[model samples]
Target: MTPSLTEAVAQAWPPAEWRDVHLLAAVSGGADSVALLRALHKLKREAGGRGRLLVAHFDHGIRGVASADDARWVAELAEGLGLECRLGVAAGPPPASEQHARDARYRWLAETAGEVGARHIATGHTADDQTETILYRLLRGSGLAGLAGVPPHRPLTAACDVVRPLLEVTRAEVEQHLRALDQPYRTDATNAEPTYARNRMRNELLPALRLEFGEGVDAAIRRAGQQAGEAQQVVGELAARLAGEARIDGSPDEVRLSPALLAAAPPLVAREACKLAWRSAGWPEQSMGAEQWQRLYTLLCDAGTAGLQLPGGVDARWVDSIVVLRRTSAD
Candidate 1:
């Protein structure tokens, strides 16, 4: 028998000790999500008043009728289970980029959670996704923060926290569970296409890796992610402290960093502190890249660089020992 997702979630969640907790299960009509919804339904049935279980789905408008079909299938599933279902459809042509689609999906999920007064949004991110994510981040030359693959839970919006109960469960296990239950799920044809990096990784790279490295790759990577999270905690604490120390009097749109303070911190600390300052100044987290980090780091370490240009039309320059970050004129 497959271990229960509800059991796993019961152990890690109820983010607060509220008696009645509302959860919005994000379903995409895929095997993993179908299994998750079933498991949540089981949990909800076993323990009444553990709050309500709701379903949310978003159509990216990319796969045309198929995407709409997924939304309908999810709605039917929710109806069959007697749960409220919320649907969000992208109005315009869907963005071609995966990240854009993901962003829109998450925003919709968060927004739906808020509307339903749910405190948490649950997703079907399994260990296979975790392995793929860490490998992808590794291939992308991501630092520890990015390498901290698929967090088990994190705040999505002010009102909702996204929880991944299946982070330790494999996709194979999810498929197996669905099969055992005689569950039907929609398959996205794009998943098998080689055009997408994740598809290539899942279809080709992972199998090749398994052949070379053996079946323990998933376990090893899971351990690595856990260790990375522990490590990130320390780094995050340091970054927070450094961000406080580096902050100087400035307008909300501007963040002034003490160059000497930043330079004195460890290299990683300095980099994260710069990111902290950048975020404090109301810039998006993804706005910074390697070049942006290097530019900011150089500005801190060198102290003589004329100015640093960042993504999102942001700029940074030094006034003696103080580093100032401000929105670009165009912004």
Candidate 2:
């Protein structure tokens, strides 16, 4: 037998000493989210006036009838549960790009929560999702930050906090709870498609791994992510301290960094120092890649009075005692 949704929530988020916090739950009329709603409702009641709950649904408008139907189902469910429901419609089809859609969805959620005076946004991300994320990042050779996977709580915006209460619950348990309660949910057809990397990993890679490695693959990956998260936090703090020590400030178009200080720091610290300089010079993070880093480092150390032009109309020049990074007007 599987644990009830309430039992799962209690295990994942212990109620003891939990303070009152305004929460906005994101529901997609899926089994996982519906189960989360039920569990949170029960927790709220048991807490005896601990916090307020709000339901938010987004219609991506991908499937003509199915999308609207999902929005309607979520709204009706929220109504029956006696929770305030906030509905939003995506102006058009969410971009084919997964990262773009994710960014847009979170932006919509953050905006809605802010408008409704909600302090936190709660998402229904299960342990399965966390495991998949960790595996994907590992396969992609992601840095320590990517290895951290999804955090339980983080600031979504300056005003709103994002919380994941179902991080420890498996999809099987969520489905069982919803089925036992006779609740219906909408399944997105696209989830079954193999074109997307995540879907391919979920449907193909994971099953093969499970068949060969046994059933503990997900748990092992999650543990690795937890350890990586801790290590990344420590590294980030050290990098920030080193950045402060090597501070060189200038206009957004022009950034200056001390060559001697950068050369003296560890390779990781040097890379982070250069990343900070690029960001301060108004260059986005993704714009700097391995080759670009190599060019910048070479210019800073070997070739004085020389500059390299980066993609995005940015230029890095070594002059006097500092390397200056500037964005060209054409960028």
Candidate 3:
């Protein structure tokens, strides 16, 4: 049997240790987020905890009146729960795309968490979201890291982390919990607009897949993600060691690599090491695709290619047996 919302939250993230820590709940007035806020509030109250519970809502300003309504509704909900609420609005028009909107929301969340001194910025990412993310990345030809899917907890900032306490809960469970409480939530019409690739997948592709393959498809994909995550963890450990050995004395803006060392390691580990080096140097990876990583790997291992230019002004060249990567300009 599926666990209750509170049971799922407790099982996924026990609240005993975190009861006294300040939490910033990202409530968008949607069913999932509203359910999350309610569940956390219930858990905290039941634990008789002295922890501060805060609510954050970011309005993308995409839907005009509807967006404003969401913000107001969330504030009211927070007040009803006797929690402090912080509301943020986009400075200008809606972002150009869904990704841009997401970026803006997260930037705001991080800032909010910092200003409020919150330890955890909790979000309402459920199992459905994870499944969607896995499918999305798989369609994009993602590497093992991307295929591993969304993590339950990640750093929003050095001092604050993004947590999903309801990751194990399904959408159906969220709605059922709300129904039992006689609670209402705002719905975004954009979710059904069909213009966004995610919506299209959720509405058309995923349903068709489920119809064709049954519920077992979701289980299979989730299993693959679990296996991929385990594999990536091993790869990350090996790559960290490889990166340590391959990195030459360098400036923060520049990373020098020993091609001999990289060439000696397995291709997968070597490529991951190169990526780690790039990330450690704070180079731009938004534009770096699998093809670019492959090209960099080839340049590092093959003797034919002397040098290569990479995204975010990173210049890689072979100087003797060393591969030098330097950021020539700011991204």
**Per-residue accuracy of model 1 over 117-221 as CA lDDT, tens digit each:** 998888888889889888888887887877788788799887789888788778888888888788899877232112378878988999998999999987887
List ranges where model 3 is wrong by over 4 Å. 1-3, 189-195, 250-254, 304-306, 309-317, 326-331
Task: Please report how far candidate 1 places residue 198 from its true position, in Å.
Answer: 0.6
Q: Which run of 10 residues does model 2 get worst, by summed lDDT? A: 186-195
What TM-score against the true fold does each predicted structure earn? 0.85, 0.88, 0.90
Superposed by TM-score, candidate 2 places the C-alpha of residue 232 at a distance from the truth, in angstroms, of: 2.2
lDDT of 3 at 4: 84
Poorly placed runs, candidate 1 (over 4 Å): 2-6, 14-19, 189-195, 250-254, 283-288, 302-328
* lDDT per residue (tens digit) for residues 229-280 in model 3: 9899998899999999999998878999999999998888998899899998
Estimate, for each residue in 218-329, the C-alpha lDDT of model 2 and write its tens digit.
8998999999999877766766777676668776567777878877777666766777656655567676677777777677666554678887787777767777777775
Cα RMSD (Å) per model? 3.2, 2.9, 2.7
Top-lDDT structure, candidate number:
3
Which of 1 and 3 is ahead in TM-score?
A: 3
